[model samples]
Target: MDDDHDDFVGCDTWDEMTAWLGESLPDIPAGVTIDFGPKDLHIGDEPLDDEFDDTDPIEALCAQIVVLKHGRYLVRRSHVVMEATNYLDHDASSATPNLWFDDDPTGDCTAGSIYVDDAGLAAEICVTWLRAESGLPDPTEFGFDISEATHLPGLPGTDAGWSLDDFLRRLGH
Candidate 1:
């Protein structure tokens, strides 16, 4: 296995991608969560799958994922795109302190999902997405220093880590 990336073998279908990612990325920390959606079946503009029946045409995609990263929400669609969004609102950087988490890929208010490596990164995204989505701790406390591998405040894994609900309650969310 190469240190740069896990021994991940590419597969054609989203199901294969799902198997590989879930099996390969075992070290994802406790609180982090990564969701994998169904594969898209489309013939040009028409969707061939039932999952997309009610979903918007543009938002429907293959291998969609939503995760938290560094106190913000990051969404990955079609395995090649990672977009940092607030999720609750698709504001698209229309205002100051936009919902994005980083300034690199997300600098222009976006990111590429290919930048995501494995579970370690996934967990960070999980916490980030949760913190923002929960609307807790107040936006005034936005700068809470949660680095990679650092558990959420009060979570069992860290000295100051806390559970998601507890963190929210502490701030009266």
Candidate 2:
């Protein structure tokens, strides 16, 4: 709802992107596991064998966010654990990424779009997340639909949601 987020689009570094996400989406809660793989020079991801490029400033980043109407793995009443990921072709290219969100940790991105800027992509992802948390569907105003995808086949995160550890261990970390 805040068009003021345009300034963040110019950010091209991991620190800057994370800082912007933190400040803008403060209500997203605290203590969620994060793979600062892109923030580093590619040391952490090699262990997990995750697919990402190290040539750019930020190749990949994911957040295990909380969702509504479903429970995480091994929990009946817990909120569903979902992940939002931003992947780029490479760092420093300024290519608009199509951020993905899904119910399962290893699930393919169920929702997203092709934006002209980075900050805008982040902003739209936040908006979609907030909307879904409130029981709303993906914002079609941005030009895409999560409902278009078939249900993902995968396991859940913890009651706390997907952890970087789960993703790692699954990848032979």
The positional error of residue 75 in candidate 2, measured at the CA in angstroms, is 27
Best by TM-score: 2
Question: How do all models score by TM-score?
Answer: 0.22, 0.22
lDDT, residue 83, candidate 1: 27
The 10-residue segment with the lowest total lDDT in model 2 = 69-78
What TM-score does candidate 2 get on C-alpha atoms?
Answer: 0.22
- Encode model 2's per-residue lDDT on 22-91: one tens digit a residue: 4432222122222211122223234435654544233232222221111110100112222333322112
Q: For every candidate structure, what is the RMSD over all alpha carbons to the true structure, in angstroms?
A: 17.5, 19.5
**Candidate 2 ranges beyond 4 A from true positions:** 1-106, 113-116, 136-173
Deviating ranges (above 4 Å) for candidate 1: 1-24, 27-114, 137-173
Total clashing pairs for each candidate = 16, 2
